[model samples]
Target: MKKIFENTQIAFALKSNNQLQLSYFLFKVMNSKLLVQLGTKILLLTLKLHLPVQNIIRKTIFSQFCGGVNEEDCLKVVDTLFTKEVSSVLDYAVEGKINEEEFDIAFVKTLKIIEFAKERQAIPFAVFKPTSFGRISLYEKITAKKILRDAEQEEWNRVVNRFDLVCQAAHQKDVPVLIDAEESWMQTAVDSLVLEMMRKYNTEKVIVYNTLQMYRYDRMEYLKKINQEAKQGAFYIGIKLVRGAYMEKENERAEENNYPSPICASKSETDENYNTALQYITENLEFFSLFAGTHNEISTYYLMELMQKKNIVANDFRIWFGQLYGMSDTISFNLAANGYNVAKYIPFGPVKEVIPYLIRRAQENTAVAGQTSRELEMIKKERSRRKQE
Candidate 1:
């Protein structure tokens, strides 16, 4: 009997034993301590923004993990990814910006990205975070108390303006804009913002997508409600699901604040909801497009199974797969090899601006059970084979 999770194209991509020797070498650098330390200094320089280091970082880590600094810069990478049959979910990697000017810049930049996608006919989608256009204090206030202050209201409105620009651009260009989910404290605001865009722009089609962090126990119910609302309003539903990203921060917050953590109590619970969300979206994939953004082999396999079980085509426009650019080449490359629609979530920005993400990538690799070690072993194995041959 075939294991449902072991037979899909994605599974083959992830678990294949015959990858090029160079494959493991790439993974090793992403997981290496030397690289991590070097990345730290580069990050500090980036934070101070010497600005000259941008090119070096761009040439190295950013080149490896991100698409490019701007739309035109992204085209070559986009074309390369397309040739390999992987799409590009282009995200501008400007994190930690906090001011009105910054917000305005972010909004304009996003609209341009949408227009750029349209012109290329190459980029399927783009994404954004609320913090890119508003203050954390405003979001946290709305999340914790479910209300806002007058000044906060002004900021919120600015955030809305930002969304309006981007969503309008996406609608005009006929591309979907994915509003990324955030930590629990601020997700209420983020969700509300995404809902507004969906209500306005999604009536004709899924021009906007709100991420569902399935690691949260409450999200499945929320997913159901959102779809119900979509049906009532006669709008298309768009979704992307992922196991939570801020596990440690969420747990620490709960410990510090004396509240129950919002993250799944265990990985098993998280995985269960993940599959449920996959099933939910597939059930409606005829009108809705969904992306599974994960590096988990089993989740990808189960989604492939669901497609087949429901008689959906592996190449259906309604379904897609994505992973961070550097971390899951095995899963990503293999999916491309097998003719499925997959993407690399290529983030590019100034090095300092993106260090936090880079560090998290390093830490995530180190923390995943045996991931770092397995990656290291593979690199060594391949390196040895190369030396002798």
Candidate 2:
């Protein structure tokens, strides 16, 4: 494919001069490892002390990385992105809730977003983390096959009910729901639950998407295994393929517990695994619909090449390209400009509630080798282009 991602004009078309400057500043800050570490500590401390810094955060990182404090607050962003032919996936970014009430709230919020997607052409999908619907420890316990006490079994049932309710609503509304992958230790339970949802709701079309963090070494085989299951069960498979977010944590836990790490041994291996999964899914489109959640331009181009070689159309409903809101605008916007299906994962929640998610975004940018630098480079180019204009 041509080097379409280099077109900064189309990429930053929606950003004002001020917004562009803010992006440049944010990436510049993220590019510094020591600054990110110190800033993360200070921000966490501020949040802990309830020090009146919400407004500052809301204006800076929160505004750049998130859509708004709630679903209603995200409509303007949804409409704005839709103007560029890019759709939105309204992700409720709140995390670490450990109670039944909080899980129910997440369930209701997901249902509401699915209904919103049903009504609006701009919002194409809804998303939630597995632990958001339940508890991480509960998922880990189930993954380990420990027998649940009556109370634990009851809690597990509620978790399953939450997943079913959200998937059922999405299916009824004809909206696809993407379930995010979490830590490897708890992911087996999530994968099983998501597969059950697929079997239940995806008999005719894909309505439930399970995310595969391709950084894990075994995901390609897992993908093939699920493909076999989907073939046998006569259901469609919806996948949101991502390189992953929890590498450091996964490696640390594996070392501490004296087990082999699940992550690919190196970034190149992870990249290869991700691209291989992309190729496999594209080749097996009869049973798979892919929502490739990536910011890597080469992987994006490789998928484009696969589509071309296989005679797949750019706008095929079975394929889509996604990037997070406020990151990788070049890939998201340029893909949309080329008539490809593109969606931005617009994370929204209260400023205080989304601090964890924002922190992860910061840490991810810091850890990913060239991600922040690439963002800085693109923003710099866009700014210079505008200055000349």
Candidate 3:
């Protein structure tokens, strides 16, 4: 990979104009009303039939968010980013599907990704959502205090087969796997699965990571307990944390279901716990591999500050920074430019299979945060700069 010719990561992290540029891009793409409308239309069509609309989707949302439909397809985009010294995490984004036959297919696809990662020098990590292989409702029932029937047990066995295949592959190939956090109700099941994987595969290298969503009021304590379990089990721990993407959904469901809301009291509270967690993890970096998944400028800067103050080396394998595949390019680009270990979570799947993801991203940006506006501002800035040239 060629060295970045423009602003480096530290420069981009340090500068005001760079922050503005980053904010601009996030707001624009996240806020693009027209693009959202078009995407909605395409998503609806996707439900009716498979439209050979790869080029259109590719140029629009896929270009912004996904890596590619498959490995060979991802090479050019991967190579382009490599030129800027940026790396990628392979994410096969198909979600919300499960059947014995279909689960086997996804299991195979996920294994192929691990194999592909070990074969490539550029790809450093991979992510998997367990729901992609099993029924979330089944997981919910199992996790809740509800007693499982024999049929549910049979179903869970199939799910376990699908999950074990992926984890076993990761163990064989020595690729780190991150299990994404899900809704609060199903999270316990996800956590259980992550623990089982860690117990089996994390004896030497941190082979599996579990995402902790700090927006939940309980996660800080939960992380502490999990860390304790890891120490007791004598296994390495891999933790990747984010502020969380499911706050409103979690709250809405909690209200409907008449359960206590799992969300933090305020955004401030979430941010505080998030920063504190980063500090705590960095201080104990020897015991854990910590990945901070954020687009928050302050959080990124604070981690760098902690690294310096604590005398932690930048080359430490336990530390990494990541943003989504399509969003937060400024953070991703600048961080990689500056030599901090960073990666973009590059998602890939058939267009039809990923509409749910697109819809959620749209809803996420549109909610009161002005996320789309930030993205739009950056795209407009880059476009205007090119125009002036």
Candidate 4:
């Protein structure tokens, strides 16, 4: 098969020159670690102080990375991706709320998104973070094997009930709901809840998908165990595999608390582990639904090769690829153009509420060596190509 990711024309088809130039400037600023760190702190403080910075943020990083402030605001983004044969996974980007009422509101927002997904063919999945619906302290307690107080027990029940409500809505709508993975300290509870939902709704097909962050050293074993449970229980398991996003925080916490780090020793180890999990899931495709959520070219190409070797059809719903909105368009769009199943994780929320998510994206881009440079190079290449044409 021909290499599809290098075609810049398809990659940037929706980006106007002005938008491309803005991205170039943003990535250039993000390339400087000091600038990203300083900018992130200043932006967060300004947003907190109710300053008049939303307009610039709305135009720059937020517009580049997020879908919109609400579902209606995301329609243009959904339609543009649909035109390119790509699909969207609507993710409400609000996070870190500790109030029960806030959790209930997030649950209701999730149901609304599911109803929206049911009506829109362009939206392939609805996604939510487990922490968004549950208390982080409760999750940490569960992970630490601690007993909960009666009040805490009631809170946990509320969390479980919220998850059930959202999953039930998705089940009724015939839309798969993705449960995003968080830090390892709180992941066990998330894992257990996702499994419960899968057992309930995934008897025939995978309606509740659990994400596995392959950067963890023990995840391959976890994947094996989950696959066994799914097979024995006669239920299909949905797995979305990613390299993980909390490497720094995870390591820092482990060091501060004097625990062995759960992360893989190196990027190469994570890559090996991720590829192994992908191969195992694909080999047992009958019992698992695989979503390769990645931006790494090698991992993406490895998946394509695995599909070819396994004889998985190009358009198989059992296998799909995903990239985040505003990043990795070269992979997302070109793969969709080549008839591969692909979707983008399109996040949306009020500009101020979503600043943390946007800042994290910027920081990650800064930390990843050559990431912003690569994006800049590709944008420049496309612009030059267009000018020549």
TM-score of each: 0.86, 0.99, 0.88, 0.98
- Candidate 3 lDDT over 356-385, as tens digits, reads 776777767676364555555545555555
Winning model by TM-score: 2
CA error at residue 11 for candidate 1, angstroms: 13
Which sections of candidate 1 miss by over 4 Å?
A: 1-56, 373-389
Candidate 2: residue 243 Cα off by (Å): 0.4
Cα deviation in Å at residue 362, candidate 2?
Answer: 0.4
Q: What tens-digit string does per-residue lDDT give for candidate 4 at 1-389?
A: 56788899999999899999988889889889999989988997887798999999999889999999999999999998999999999999998899988898789889989999999999989999999998898999998889999999999999999999999998989999999998999999899989999999999799999999999999999999988998788888999999999999999999999999999999899999999999999998989898899988888898899999888888899999999999989999999988899999999999988988998899888887777888888988998998999
lDDT of each: 0.76, 0.95, 0.76, 0.91
Mark the 10 consecutive residues where model 3 has the least summed lDDT. Answer: 2-11
Q: Which one is best on lDDT? A: 2
Candidate 1 RMSD to the correct structure: 4.2
- Deviation of model 2 at 196, angstroms: 0.8
The segments of candidate 3 whose C-alpha lies over 4 angstroms from its true place after superposition are: 1-29, 32-42, 45-54, 368-370, 384-389
In angstroms, give how far residue 290 of model 1 lies from its true place: 0.5
RMSD of each: 4.2, 0.7, 4.6, 1.0
Residue 321's C-alpha lDDT in candidate 2? 95
- lDDT head-to-head 2 vs 3, winner: 2
